[model samples]
Target: MNTLALRLFAIWLVVFGSVGISLASEFFSEAEKTIIQSFGPWPPPLIADPSNSVSQNSEAISLGKKLFSERRLSLGRDLACSDCHAPDQFFTDGTALNSAHGRATRNTPGLLNLRWSSWFGWGGAADSLWAQSIRPLLSKEEMKFTGKKLRELFSEDIALTQKVQELFEISVVDQSDEALFVIVGKLLAAYEETLISGLSEFDRFNVALSASDNIGIESYLATAKRGLKIFIGKGRCNLCHFGPTFTNGEFGDIGVTQFITKGRIDKGRYQGIKALQSSPFNLLGEYNDDQQGTSRVRTEHVTLQHRNWGEFKIPSLRNAVKTAPYMHNGSIETLAGVVEFYSNLDEERLHIRGEKILRTLNLTPQEKKDLVAFLRTL
Candidate 1:
């Protein structure tokens, strides 16, 4: 024991700490940077929907918020849109399927970032957000109200009807039940469009990386960074889940079972396309707000084929950590389970010929954990 021994130990400690700090300060690799860049900048621009005239109307948004929480919108007066899309849980009721008149055929998706979506619903049945909003109100399985019932309810409430007239400048009493219903849907859509997700940890990371600030990178978890690499590279998750919202807003069939019940097979996009074409509330219909007929293009030219069978909309990954169980059927209970589903994906069950994007990842246990870690940051 001596002064020299103490000095040598102190030098060793300093050297070891310096090495650790250097490792922590390391930047992303060139290949990894390329992949990360593809995800683009975070907090994407707020794009208005041409199909919904009131999409940016403040008064409409206010009315829509009230209508969203109004239980009278449903048949039995037992449920409101808020009942399923609870604001507390990131607008999802945290159920695989919501039960109102009957069990919902699909999971209740979060309402955040609906303004950016080209289509709505798991099957993309509704070509516009307003059209999608009107669907559940008329659906026997959901709100369980006919156009007549909705019109009658509004007609009875003189104050409510008057307010609607003042805000929308439409005579609810004189308008046909269908026309009134469409307006209500449009108002609801206006409010829902405002439910944009806030900035997240990943978003901050992107900001830091873009600024070339070493201290900013410290805000993101190292484990999450590794997972992001896997997501864009080996996991191939970016193929379906790319963009600021971590979704391409397109439909895909990734081998998840399409059966909702023994007798019923949820045909997904195949049935959605058929329903969209037949829908009176569709974007191509007379009710569309777009005078230029530009917004109807997706619905007008949408191709329906056998390949669309069992395909479902790619859910956004933003706030995915909060909304679970996952998938159209809510078949997976946890984010970990979702990762596992893709990890050991059954290639045999997949429409390999139709959707060549999906394949069995065969991710190792560590890789699965890493992918899940990355998703949680979303």
Candidate 2:
């Protein structure tokens, strides 16, 4: 090993000698320690959603949780949001494309840590969590419920009707379909915001580093420690997948194919921008509860571009072990498959105007294993 590497090892020895533990995970430089510290202190602060009126209200969240699995909300009285976003499966239906309903165009992303996300969906079609909640309800391919259907369902469902009246302070029958739609969306968003993942083994390791608790560090998986170095070091995974929630909450084109069907290509953020600008529920629209006007800044200024055609949201990696198959359309079946794709990335799949950030990693076999071991701790 070189001087720095030897020093990194020596520091580990000195730190752990008193604790009487000798583990491969103990190696670290001051620089590496700083980078590792950036991962977290897990479970980031919950910011209030200015666009959703009932953002953190407990009553709304309770009702929304009930509504999440309420099958009657669908037109056919069959599908519910939970049907695709199964609660047991990290709130993600472990499928590439959810065919539980009609046929979804993209993978069902996990609901963990959504309160920290600035944008929602793979294509980022909505600006607020409430707006995104409204999507599956209205889509014919998902919950398959229209505003009119919701009005009818709420009218006859005595228990839900009573809950809506108590929380909203308005009878469901008195409200327009549009008003009811917004109300339900806000309620759901209030509940979805609570779906945060607990701290993982990686978080514990980060904490140990912060306290210089060498024995605590030794408890962390040795291979995972090496992998964590690769993630924040030469692999540069931290550039996109950094911070407490493990994502930057932005879109990117990482050479993943955008073809949804043979002829019907998923235009990703290109079409998402069009839909977002036109959506009546967007943060730029009248339904936004934020009176301060600052909450809509991102939605107000986003410009459409050709490069956005294939770009998709960079999802948080907190619950990666629970959410699969991976990628935008769920093309990759396993986490290792995702790693392999990046290891020998096919850059030709990317368009000329696409992001230049990605290149073939060409990771060694052992490197791939180490990297995957780190990801598991996430």
Candidate 1 scores a C-alpha RMSD against the true structure in Å of 4.6
The lDDT per prediction is 0.84, 0.85
In model 2, which range of ten residues has the least summed lDDT?
Answer: 17-26
TM-score of every prediction relative to native:
0.92, 0.92
The candidate scoring highest on lDDT is 2
Q: Which 10-residue span in candidate 1 carries the lowest summed lDDT?
A: 18-27
Once fitted onto the true fold, the runs of candidate 2 whose alpha carbons sit more than 4 angstroms away are 1-26, 348-351
Error of 1 at 212 (Å): 1.3
lDDT of 2 by residue, 10-122 (tens): 89878766554533334777788887888788877788888887888999999889889989888899988898889999998898888887688899998878988988888
